[model samples]
Target: MNLNSIHNVYFIGIGGIGMSALARYFVANGKLVAGYDKTPSEITDSLRALGVEVHFEDAVSSIPKSCLNSESTLVVYTPAIPQGHLEFEYFKNNNFKILKRSQILGLITENTFCLAVAGTHGKTTTSSILGHLLNECDVPLTAFLGGICENYNSNLILNGTEVSVVEADEFDRSFLTLSPDLACITSMDADHLDIYGDASELKKSFVDFSKRVKPNGKLFVRNGLPIDGITYGIEDDSDYSVQNIKIENGSYVFDVKTPKTLLENLQFNLPGRHNLSNALIALAMAVEYGCPHRQLANALASFKGVKRRFTYQIKTDNFVYIDDYAHHPEEINAVHQAVREMYPNKKVLAVFQPHLFSRTRDFIDDFAKSLSQFDELLLLDIYPARELPIEGVTSAWLLSKIANKNKQLVSKQDLLKKIHESNAQIVLTIGAGDIGEEVKHIKKEFNVAN
Candidate 1:
């Protein structure tokens, strides 16, 4: 558990969003870091530019010579990596000290005053805002975020060790490994049903995570989350709440009512009421940690947003396009709500790539109902991240249930051409899949046409 004993750090799935953040942390701390991934990505390219050796092949020979020692090298892998991964097995067979990404996170924050953000959907945005608030307040802190913060341009926010911030993920019950001095749960919707098997079990897992907050620490939950703690909501009876919200120049300006004080004229540019709640949670956590209300408001104002979380690829006078990583039904519904608010009565086309086969099977009807809200739909094939295809679950099958007559199935290869042919003024690319990799191409095609 002592990180000081580790001289070299290696990763099996080094290119994963969360795993790459840890890789950056190790490299920034001056550790000899190297790793393997199944493919090259923007993350892998970034790691290589930092002089950390990264390989696509999973062979043990690809392991750097400096990372082979059992006593000094710490092996980290994501849950997405299979149990039979060769490099992981080699590390196991050789008795090298190894751990899950969450275990290592627990170790890093074990000594620092930790602030953990846990939820089914809003954890990344909340953690990013919280990290920005702490940084703006000049706190000695490091935030291990789930998504890349656009403000910092990295998932791992670099700072001194007095305090630490992290996204407390629930997959594989990973958040249970953390010891947090302060924490917040944004939402407790049924997700990762592949792991927990049912909604009740997933809710129970969150309750267990709430108990990990250290004695004398605070736990903030969104109002009505069924947890005993300080609560935050928009226009609700909660410990922390937002009031008098209004949109000004494409940004939301609102007032906050906390237990001790009421702060007004808070501004956030991110769309949706869900995001307003996210800002409120971050503000609540930072205020509890003693960040000045004035400084927190300034930080919230400057917060650009997380990449791929309602990201704008093209926003011009002629056309508008947005891409999001909203895989769950609730997330898609939030995207729908945001779009409806921004472009009400305008023709909009939704191009969605369902993330996982298991998730599609679990929420087929829900997905259909959510996607049907748009003016038109172009459904892409499901991105089977780690799961094999379910027998009857496919994008075409899900498309059939959609109540929209404008819905049709489209392949990724044909996506751009299909988009260009559409008469709709606004386009939405929504999903948590490899569809993100195609954003650059989509933007380019639109730019050329315009």
Candidate 2:
């Protein structure tokens, strides 16, 4: 299955962030690219703008005739696609060369020097930062990221063929497909319990991923994670660590202590100590890839963040609005830490839409505790991405566990009205669901009030 032999690339779930990145990659490489998604989205629109034909309909007829050749056309699909999907069934029955998104990433990145970032959280941001650092350092690199990079304004970063940076996704064990020259596990938090069933299994999967690093390649893991790798952490003992960190003029100013030397006064614009850890891991990896120390520092300063990962929508003195894709308890805790460190006195209002019913059921207590840190809370019903509704798992049930007195469950229709009525200075909408689609409206409403 040589990718060079393929003339057309068809995606079954092209609207997904990771899938769209691959679509862009194929289209950029001069291949005929088209796909079907369940719904139209900004991502699909962007792919279409790039000359990749995208249709929202799921009917088998929506697939282009160009993709009919089973041998020359590559059919890629996300695991989230249903087993009964029409286009999927068409490809399956026709004996098309089908590949999972991760398998395709592995195939494309095999010959290149791959820097794979793997974890339950922070994979997107870490990979995006690494890509930016390499590009700024003038390293000939290409990065396939899982989120839209604000600096490049695309999930796929292309420069040269020598190096490839990618997000090593853990969902559906996708990261296992990648054979990385250098890999980092930013976190191994228990998630996707519907898949792994427990935290230990999730940890074992990460351990297996770490072992997948090439014999001579490097593996970086966050400190204290249950794995053997060169460790990274914030102001702690690890092979690479950030120390003397301070927020200066709205950016994080810190020093990274690596195995060889201490890179001082490193500047990262992203917020949070967890982000600082992310930056440190990216910096270390870039240096290992032969990027100069000074170059790493410069790149860190210029690296813009990933969209929806602690993304600041509005940053004015009077009002601040942030949007994050934190769907788990550990991620929410990181967000809480960032907000408290930045605006200690400001009243914070959090609007969270739980991602899946299974996750909500597994970590309801943890979610309740993390969300309680907010001064006020507005909880939306679960998003249920690929899960059937579990009995007794509802956002209202989770909201009831929150200790905050200023908490209520609200519908999307009344979300804006509730925000307008609140006196909180820092407003955050946190989730890994359709809540992001509402960010623009929330920002517009705040701007109009201002």
Candidate 3:
């Protein structure tokens, strides 16, 4: 538990977004770091650039000798890693000090002034904004984000170690381990049904997380969430409210009403009401933490956003291509709203890949409803992450349920061809699976950028 005493650290899923941030943190602190992942990715390449040893094989031989010491080396594994994994079994049987990624994150932030963002959605963007805001205000803080912030080009924001900002994840009840001085629940939408089994249980977990805040700590919730906290919303009576919202030149210019005063004409460039709400909560938390309003406003305006969330691959007057990591139905609806608002007169073609089989089965009707709103739809086969496919659950089945007449079930190979035939002015690639890997190919096919 004493991180200072540990000289070497190993990760079982080092290429994961959250896990890679931890790997970078340990490397920056002068630990001999090495790990195993199922595949190579941009994350693994960046870690290698930082001198961390990473291997794709699962054999125990891939582990470095320095990590064999039980007392000196600590093993951090993500929940996605199966229990039958070879390196995981080796660490288990050899009496190594193994810990889940969230447990180690909890330990790292326990002694610091921790500001944690917890919810089913908005965890990544909200926490990234908070980290940026505090860092801009010159607060000595270390932020561990769940996604790569475009502003920093890395998930781990290392300004100082006295304060810590973290995305409090709810998957497998991981957020329960974090006891924060300031926490916010951006949403409580039912998700990860494979883990919680029901929506009520997921709500219970968020309630439990709200209790994890330290005494005298502040908890902020979205305006209408079923929780007691200082509330924030777009334009309503709440402790932190945004008013006079206007979109000019593809950016938001608004005003924020805080508990004590109003911040006028604040600007944020991200393209969703959901993202604006995210910016508001981050600003609220920074304000409550005693950060200067002028500095926080400046920081929020400058936040570039997380990489896959509403990232514009190509933007021109004739055509637009956007990529987003919106796996859930609600998230998809938000993306639809933002896109339609931005280009009301143009036609849109949405290409979607369902993330998990269980999730697809759980919300099939909602998925169909959301996807039906686009001018055209191309549905890819489900990406079964950590789950076996259920009988009668497939992309074709979901596509059949879609009320949109323009929808089609398509293969990855023919995706670009189908897109080429569409006359829509705007195109979207939306999902949280290997669909993201396809972004580069899609970008290359466009052959132009604005």
Q: Give me the candidate number with maximum lDDT.
A: 3
TM-score of 2: 0.98
Runs in model 2 with CA error above 4 Å?
Answer: none
Estimated TM-score for each candidate: 0.99, 0.98, 0.99
Q: Model 1 off-target regions past 4 Å? A: none
Looking at candidate 3, the ten consecutive residues that score lowest on lDDT are 441-450
Superior candidate under lDDT, 1 versus 3: 3
Model 2 root-mean-square deviation: 1.0
The segments of candidate 3 whose C-alpha lies over 4 angstroms from its true place after superposition are 448-450
Give the C-alpha miss distance for residue 198 in model 1, angstroms. Answer: 0.8
True lDDT of residue 64, candidate 2: 88
lDDT of 3 by residue, 32-83 (tens): 9999998888999999999999999999988999899999999999999876
Angstrom error at residue 229, model 1: 0.6
Ranking by lDDT: 3, 1, 2
Cα deviation of 181, candidate 1, in Å: 1.0
lDDT of each: 0.91, 0.91, 0.94
